[model samples]
Target chain A: MAFVLELNGLTKHYGNIQALRQVSLEIPQGTVYGILGPNGSGKTTMLGLIMNILQPTGGSIRLFGEAPRADHRQKIGTLLETPNFYHYMNAVQNLQIAAAIKGVTNPDIDGVLEKVNLLQRKNSAFQTYSLGMKQRLAIASCLLGDPQVMVFDEPTNGLDPVGIAEIRDLIRRLAADGKTIIMASHLLDEVEKVCSHVAILKKGVLIAAGHVDEILAQDDLVEVSAANTPQLPELLKALPHCKQITAGDAGKWLLHFEQGTADLRSVNEYSFQQGIVLDHLLLKRRSLESKFIELTN
Target chain B: MNLNIPHLLRIEWMKVKNYKAFWILMILFVVSMIGINYIYWYVKQQFVASGDIAAQAAGSMIFGDFRFPAVFKTVSQMSSWLLYFPGFIVIFHTTNEFTFRTHRQNIIDGLMRKQFVVAKLAGAFLLALVCTLLILLTSLVFGLISGDGYFSLEGLQYIGFFFVQSCVYILFAFTLALLVRRAALAVGIFFIYGLIFDYLLAVWISRGTETTLGYYLMPLQVADELNPPLAELKKVIGSTNQWIALGISIAWLAFYCFFPIRKFEREDL
Candidate 1:
């Protein structure tokens, strides 16, 4: 597979405390890859290493499948940690600086600001901006030069609900435009919502990683309780697609089925044909949050 | 990226052009530098006008010092005391990166570690050059005001020394700010050390060894005799050799230039 970013045996140590362990990840081109972890789980450290914000204790990083050079980073737009702009300068000025560093000439700062919904306040000093506006401004900077690869670390941090939704929507839109986005967040729902691929981390160790659907739980669960619960298991145990049968709370039987194959009506009809009167029946799709909890814990 | 020196300076300008505090500090530096030179010249003028016995006896030393070549040393020395003003500007500008964490952002935006630090060191260099120009302008004003009509580039090396002195002061502040990464703490330590500790350390070393080694030992102290405010104390203090001081001062300059680049380049931002 062609990779946009590749990390090999990457490790980081802050004094004696290891911030990131020996873990490797490869992000394919055109995938919205998410680095999901809790706080202090080395998510930021890993991103920092890739961007050269932090030096790795061991191993190496490759950008666009080549040895990373400073200019190689020019093609990657990044908002690491916070919206770090000159507080005294306005948004247009801040993007101008970013453009200058990226070697972009005659950059459309207003265009990027418009994309991030910050063009209206493009002339306001960054210090006067609210946290949400500041974050949007940072996203605006990341959009400057129209880089193919973008990395956002906790991009929605310090934003209001509407701001978070806007950012998420923007990320989704960016991804849909075939831009390769590598986002680092502790937000499970965020990864579930916008990420095509995900790598889970816990305390510097890689827990799991792959396509989101492949890595996360894709099971359909059925909760059925009959007045004679004993007879329900025999009926559920023989179901064609049922994978597991376990006793649930309140005298209910929970049966796991392969995703999208659990037919609830068919299960109820078969249970009734088996002379079992079902008292309650419900179908529950396994949430990514629960799967994230399972993987992280 | 147009990361050449001029482009680098242009980018640096973009950062500080709108900063009110930067302008305020720069204005304060220039005004105070010119202010001190003017006041000193005015005092000497007042003494010369008094027509007293001692004033008449020292007339050549006072009035003649402000003309032609001597005016360069006179203004350079007078302006040296206000080096802290520009030093503070350098500290604020550098530590502002850490304070705002823009250094990291700059690096993420494709600025090499060397480029970021080089830009900072370059800022200090530009500031030093500006301070030197101010000294030059002050020297010309003093020389023209002396009315001796005898102007020569005889002691112009003193003005050059003043430029080097300015670089030492500002880059010393730059190194301190890079290490501490806090404006207030860096500025505090810069003033407290440059004003108090550097002098005391040199004095202590001098008094202990009965040699000029002490004077040339410290970075700021090495340039003490360059734009000397105290001329008579040279004989009394057994002043350091100019060549030795210059050599040691250059070593410090190298430190001030490369240390920040090396530190930022080698470590995590």
Candidate 2:
């Protein structure tokens, strides 16, 4: 994949507090990349550095093969934090200011407003709108000029379920249109569902980075339940495929399989020959949440 | 969006329009200046009507001329406004950013720090220009009753002084706001700078100090001191004083224009 943004050994410090330390990552074009970290873990700091909103004390970042500058900023759209519109101005006016700053002229400000479903509220003052509408307004601002790269920091923050869903759909639709997105979020589920690639940070250090599925994949665990599972745990101890056996709740027995060992027909047959009746058997997989905890922990 | 400078300026102007309080204050300031001039003109008119030479000289001291040529005096009065108002308004600008928390968003919304700074300075300058013109027109009305001529070289110089002072306002207000990063604090400090601190320092120096520092401070020396036509007044104060004040103001303008721009651009907004 071609890298659209690359940062190398990035570091930042305020007084004695280090906000970012040696953060190096490459975001490829057209990928929904997620930066995951807890509060004060430097997620916002890193995004600020990448977007050229903050100067890094050390290291450098390149956007589209050039260092980020005022000219290069036109190519990127951003929705950082809450929608910050002039409280007195209507949605259209707010977007007008945004478009001007980006050097775009006479845009169908109404058109972009319509996409965020804010067409009706385009004439209303931003302070009059609900929090969800405010967020949508922020997204609408980001949509101006159809920028190639988009960065949203905690886009769903302080939104209700419906708002979150709307923003999620919007993000997904934008990604589907071949737009590159770098979303930094503390919400694990949001990142898990929308992101193609993920990077998890703790404190100021990147602890994990890779594709979601690969990062979350688990070694197989086959759960076997029988009428006499209490005895089955003892019976499973002899099998070479069984790395370990544990008694599970509901009278089930868990058989941990060795990595690269998938053939379980022989073990099942042996259980059958031993007069062990299998009520149900299934493989257990790790969820993203579980993997996230494991990785960060 | 292609960033259009004119479009941004227009948008900024629209935002300024929404500030009813600021415009109200502007009107109040101009009206007060006009009222003072009117009162002075009325007294002078009585003396001239009486045909008393001694009274006429005394009346000129009190009322001054109230005609278009008197725009010179109006310019002088308005020039000080240009110098001081921005420092006050700048607190509004800086604090509005903090109160509204828009500075962070402005950074995030793809606005370069340099652009934001320029837009503010330009906006403040534009506001100052409007205020200067309004006072000038008010003075012209006062001059109409006095039957004075309109638009002289001195009057143009008054305009120049007001314009330059407006630029100084832009520099001082913006720089102080950026440095303080808080509206109320910056404004309060500016109030002290304008009202109390500069005067106190000037009095302290003029009384006994050998430093002659009071003459160097623009805010201290310009208090009710007028400009342009005030060359005579300034001369009474000493040519060195004017030069020193100009030098200090320029130094401050340079700091605001460059230093804060660099600092804020590098800072994490």
Q: Which consecutive 10 residues in model 2 chain B have the weakest lDDT in total?
A: B220-229
Off by over 4 Å in 1: A228-235, A272-275, B1-3, B57-64
iRMSD computed for candidate 2: 2.2
Model-by-model DockQ, in order: 0.86, 0.51
Best by DockQ: 1
Off by over 4 Å in 2: A218-285, B1-8, B46-56, B67-71, B78-87, B148-152, B218-244
Tell me candidate 1's interface RMSD. 0.7
Fraction of true A-B contacts recovered by candidate 2: 0.48
Chain B of candidate 1 versus the native chain B: what TM-score?
0.94
lDDT of 2 at A46: 89
Q: Estimate, for each residue in A1-297, the C-alpha lDDT of model 2 and write its tens digit.
A: 688888899999878999989989889999999999888889988887876767789998988877777656667788775667788778877787778667676777888888778898889988899988898888888899888899998998777898799889989999999999999998888998899998888888888788966665555567788774467877767777677887666777777765456456766887887779788777775355666777777
Report the lDDT tens digits of candidate 1 across residue range A116-168.
78888989999999998998998998998888999999999989888899999
Q: After superposition, how far is residue B128 of candidate 2 from its true place, in Å?
A: 3.2
